[model samples]
Target: MILQNKERIVIIGFGPVAASLVEGLLPAVTAGTIELIVVSSEKHLAYNRVLLAELAVGATRAEHLGMVDETRLRNAGVVLQLGRTVKRVDRSRRQVLLEDADPLSYDRLVFATGARPTIPALNGLNFDPHSEAQLPHGVLALRTLEDAMNLNKVLQGNGRVLVLGGGVLGIEAALAMAEAGHRPVLIHHGPAPLGRVVDADGGTLLIRSLRAAGVEVISEARATGIQKDETGFTGLVTQTHGIIEGAALVLSTGVRARTELASSCGLAVNRGIKTNEYLAADIEHRIFAIGDCAEVAGQAPVGLLAPGWAQAGWLAQYMLSTPAPGPADPSLHDPISLAPPSLESSDVLMLKGQGLELTAGGDIAAGLWDESGSQVTVFADPAEGKYLKMVSQAGVLTGFLAMGLPRTSAELVLSYERGSMLPADRSTLLRLDDPGILEPAGAPGPDDQLCRCSGATHGQVAHAVEAGCTTVAEVGESCRAGTGCGGCRAVIEAMLKTPVPA
Candidate 1:
């Protein structure tokens, strides 16, 4: 679809995806090629929902989490309509009807309405007083930043907090509440905490960590109902056990894709709005879905912020450019695969090229293994909760995983990928610290995979430089490297200025 000058684009949901799209369209918006309108049910502008746990712990203020600056958005020609919900979409007329406003027509409609927290049905349970509608004052579910702030206010006074579910959000909330000096009791029907994302061992480790942090965890206990008293919440009824007392409850059970608008408009709805590889919904040609609302390849929404950011970038590129032949390549879009958090404990050994050259050795668990039979070693302590694992075989480093250490892993991985020989001993490897390690070596070639997250090879980046791709953004556009975690960005820039060896 060719976007004409003065074409109107209306976006629903003023969350991360929508904000990102608007920020990306700044050039087009400034040039008067597109007119944009963002409709949000929230009263506040788009904010970072990923940091809600931090908000709960009081680490970050509520206003600081906003994804976009309102002034910047306004200056870029985006019309902000907050505190309004889209009642219905009349696709035939190409207009969206808001709850209290006249129908607004659009040249293109983008569904970034996002997902809401899924509050399960329980008997005799009333919504919390701070809830949006006051269905009951006994149950509280957090999805929005406002929800987190309200829950934080309610949790201020001394009271028992029974957090339901043991997923990432639940664990995060439980940890945050515990850190805030609130005694939180976690209930999960699953076998362990973070059961969906992490493996059994990793979950066990996480549960142990939470318990050490003073959280009472109950697994295999499903919340069946809630009992309330005149003062507030009274008790929680579980399937396996009888009722347990509680002053307040925070439900972190899970979330479903917010598809009310899509379903109401008669779009193909499964657990989420089904989208092709390009993130475009199967029903609407012009409309697309991204972030938590779109389901790709039957995978349940991971709800992590990074994947959503990647999806939004890809969608923006596709929307702005001509239609490419065939289905959109999944390889082009790097959705982080849902792997269990690594919990290995073994001694890490590294070999760069030939001879038993020792780079950095550490203790790692046996579980974290590569395709080869060699076990990953971790030099860092698991008890202190700082771990590093690096894998190498036949005088070459294959893979490395480090939780807290940043440049160590990046340097080691770069050395391995470039087939550079490691320092003779552990002391030498450890002594060669940060800024020095990033310096280009005379022997090693520049075309090494410095960042494994994006599979960015130095050669492809060098080629971009030869092709007049002078800036990092230009290189990213040309080769799609250094775009994921961006940890190697500084290294890439450093390499650009260095001269090649004869």
Candidate 2:
């Protein structure tokens, strides 16, 4: 299919980044400057994958996970081909061949194919590379909605739910299952879960909290094979130990970027589709990539959602400036430059569930005996499942990890993000965990991030409120302050209840 006059832009993959890009380009599409066609292999609309585990445990609904306005997209004259797979890219004719559909030609093509779950090789489990192979009956990866549904069904069964991997997803899955009254055993090959981010002592505290929450953690164990009986799956055979019995298995072993299409079409493929700072896969051919599929030069695809969203927004603006794929339209206001957006910033990871509060960010590898002259403070209470470590350089908070201390962690996160100097009495920070101790009456500054998930700030929320948004839900709809993870909902509520700073 071809169109005359209008620039036809075809985007493959409809994940969060793709959805954001489509949202960003709707104005141009409505202006008749561009026509957007999105092809997605999944049947459902773009949804929040971060809440998949909660959905699996029946804690959240599918409607709550939606990330896009489908009605708005359809009304904007965007063509959405859901549950369809692209067969190949015929670059010579600038057309994409789809299975069971006519070839769709494009002036520009974007590959947002996203990433796939990494399935570990084990006995009794087989995966096909050429096709989208389904895992065996009792085994699944907690990556997609289908996998979450399967996991929910597996959780309804009697036997133990074995979770393999020690990443954030694996830990969250295990904890969720345990809370839902299912027997969950988390097996990891490392000394403990989150070894990369958490030190050995911090890992010990995390293990204690998991155990207290009724999750059986098996550390330093590698699953070598899968044991099966007349039933689908019986257990996982390990190298260090014998067979660890379980009814179903969840593989939370991370993800690999989808680069099959880019590689087949002659795009430089490394960890992902190699692109320059401008997110162009092949600028000469007008082919570009973003999200998990695009490996920007000198940097691998980050697993975080913030960077991907930033890239989508940046690329969308860039595309809007250059509607016909040549030099940027000089008449366009604020035409995007060839320079890439700055994405270098500290990443904060917060895990709160099952009576556990853990917050970690930035370089927390500082030790007690460090001669680097960085001020490092350590506090530990293993019996109570509490540990706190703060690393500061030149009195500025650099990195910190707080488990079982929510209030202190909150202060640490604010200080770290703001690059503020720590107070003279560091012991006073520990008093924040007390319920009676109230925070000073003042809201975060305009630039301070109120919602880490969406990266919404106090100024943005205030603007939304001033624009007549009275409630938390209205603020979320207006500025996306509480839309992601719902971690910032309380703060948004508090801000709405009181007058924000000017």
Candidate 3:
């Protein structure tokens, strides 16, 4: 049913969100109702940015990072303009000006430019976002495949890798580097790594785990300037640690939404490209934004893939359902109005690595001395590299942070999501890590969330496995589990080995 008048959709940026969007819209694409054009500045096709750390450590290959099949996309009549940049947008003409290329007209324009690494402003480092300023030699950010390749080169040598920032990526990078037989020195200004997500007690256990994994932890140390010579980057000069020698510096500081194109085109720009609940940029023409670049309802993108994937799927369906405005009637906005589901915040944080396992969710900052009605329980054994804190409100698990206990963390996450009441005795929950201890009722049910990122439940994964999905990757392809963050991979594997009872 190829229509003569096909709605032209131009999507800029081909990341995970864009990949998901294309997958969702494949049916419509095959039906020939709409024509799709994907443009990206990166030369490579869409790949999983979540596994950059694993790639850097040589644990995963570049081919494994691909999110979409280019051949399939091309076969579906998708016009992919790779390694191309959209320099300008003409709202009146409904055309996007490209760099060294002809202007591309579109019936609907989607901004999926995602985000860029937040290069820290340090002495001896001049990174101008507006200009093409290169980072100093021996310094990098593990955000892309190119960065991973460069970082891998540095890790191959016998010098200490200075990892600045103690966020999830930073920790993963440091641990991966250490696992790959490289020296890594983790420097953070806070009392411990993951300070924003985990409390002090949990942080202490994390620091211990890092040390056990051969990563040197330098806490409360703020890096002020870069230490470099004619050869290359020597190390970093910290306010507390003074001069810390290293072969390369990996900045996992943060990320900022790439909103330059949106801002230049008179679109509302806050921390990201501003959009309404329907992912519309409030323009008369069909202009929408999603992924890490879209800031909807004053909520900025947190650099998480789950929310972006959700937006991508929703936007794809929305575009398909709504009728496009007539060519002559430019001012007539489509009457279709269905608000997208609210994006969930990163309440659940899990750090999975060798010699380290932690999961924290909700507000676990409530102290034991608090006179509040919430019951706070703390279990700490520094010698054993274990810690657990649960904040229960009226017997329901409100908040929790666990370390060195994978089983307990999994159970806690299940309970947290369910809002289920904790056992009368807290020790019973702690004993989950004990050998040969069967789950005392209230275990992971069929409906329990197995993959938080994909919203895939235990039963969903079980069904996928029963349908002949043998491996984790197969299950992921079937049910979209273990695709984001890779935190729930272990559980998915466990389920595959031991069938979940109906």
Candidate 4:
């Protein structure tokens, strides 16, 4: 007897987070255990938003940005609905109200609402939040493919551009525009560029790197208003300084969790939709939230894509391992733990940008430093535009900054993620292009997670290799590593190059 009928699963949003969710549900979906309905507000097919910068500068085309192909969805029997907004979520009826269609009922609801770009509330900048507009010509935000398409038009001209905000997104935008042969000036509110991740000294090095790439980094300035004309956004006006003229303005101000839909339905709300470690919404155990829009209270949201993928895996396990309830099931009175048994401990950030390599996370901040217990070491070479910071706690590695150090950036990311103890002579770890000395240096440890995007471990990849997978593509096909974000492609290639010890 069927313990429970196939679950009617409805997933809202189709970004990386939602894609990860689909990856997790693929097994069940293919097994005829669940009916998947993915509803996204984006009109286009699911695509990787991380590479929008490349699309803007003419490096990559639109066809390459897509994340999901229709053939795969059709084979898996997934109902992929795009360009539709969920106006209302009725928790009582377990239904979602769409703007141009009928209600989508679900036995389980996944709120992967993701985030929306922050359209700065500057004077003369008018954006109606209720409706999605084509973003009048000239004004741009590097958040979506449509914005990137419009930006491509702006990049075709040899005109100067003004970029607001100095975070990772802003930096990438400025660099891309500069590479496109346009003069790009970056205005950051902080004392230096990339203030949040890098300290004053590290940020100084970042500015130099940006400058070397033809980007003008303006520090300690704030944009009070924006100037507009009949054409659209014209330029930016600073607080004290005079107007900064530009042919167009690109706002990479950052993003906020989209919580209106969940909040309107009487779900618990915090900085994002409140979900437990298992990603189950507090409103109902069956209702789950993930990605940039969901966070556990007292813990900062893992705005990056890795945590969302991890949560998707955890939810998949929760669904598979738990016994399905039969008729007269007491599931309503008793709920199950949906969070992963043990999520990855250390925070990891390996930002993606061509020519500019920077990986900072896992207690890399100065505030996490304590003279009595931690060692903060730094080295910078202006000639090579490289900066490295290794924060060690009680004789073990904690966090680091590997900016412009191309060779060891991926190594440092993996080491930090693994929480492996630093070797006695860790100065070698700071040395560029040298593994120097590691407690276990030859190959990735069996327990180490090699790809954060796919949560594939070293052992898994090695097993695939042992099974005659000689190429990165073969390994990705064998174990599904390097399939998300494409940041780990280099790491996978490095693994292929390293010989197995006899």
Off by over 4 Å in 3: 1-4, 127-133, 330-339, 498-502
Local distance difference test values of all predictions, in order: 0.63, 0.83, 0.85, 0.75
Clashes of 3: 0
| Model 2 residue 317 CA deviation in Å | 1.8
List candidate 1 segments past 4 Å from native: 1-5, 125-135, 196-204, 282-284, 297-300, 322-502
TM-score of each: 0.67, 0.93, 0.94, 0.86
Poorest stretch of ten by lDDT in candidate 3: 126-135
lDDT tens digits, residue span 1-502, model 4: 1125788788999987787778778888888988889999888876778789888889889987766667898698888889898998987677999999999987778899888877777776655553343454576787889888877777787667788888877887888778777788998888887776787778887888788888998888878887778887777888856788887788888777888899999988787898776677753467888878887644546676666777776777776666333334434455565545344444666655546788887666654446557877777786777788888777666878878775566666666666677666766655546556443343457868777766788889888877878898789777767766676787678778878656
**Residue-wise lDDT of candidate 2 within 407-460, one digit each (tens)?**
788888888888888887787888887789877322368988888766778889
In model 4, the runs with Cα more than 4 Å from the true position are 1-4, 126-136, 282-284, 321-331, 334-346, 351-355, 362-373, 407-415, 418-426, 430-443, 468-474, 477-480, 497-502
Among all candidates shown, the one with the greatest TM-score: 3
RMSD of each: 9.9, 3.1, 2.4, 3.9
Candidate 4 — what's its lDDT?
0.75
What is the descending lDDT order? 3, 2, 4, 1
Ranked by lDDT, the better of candidates 1 and 2 is 2
User: Which has the greatest lDDT?
Assistant: 3
Order candidates by TM-score, high to low: 3, 2, 4, 1
Q: How close is candidate 1 to the true structure, as a TM-score?
A: 0.67
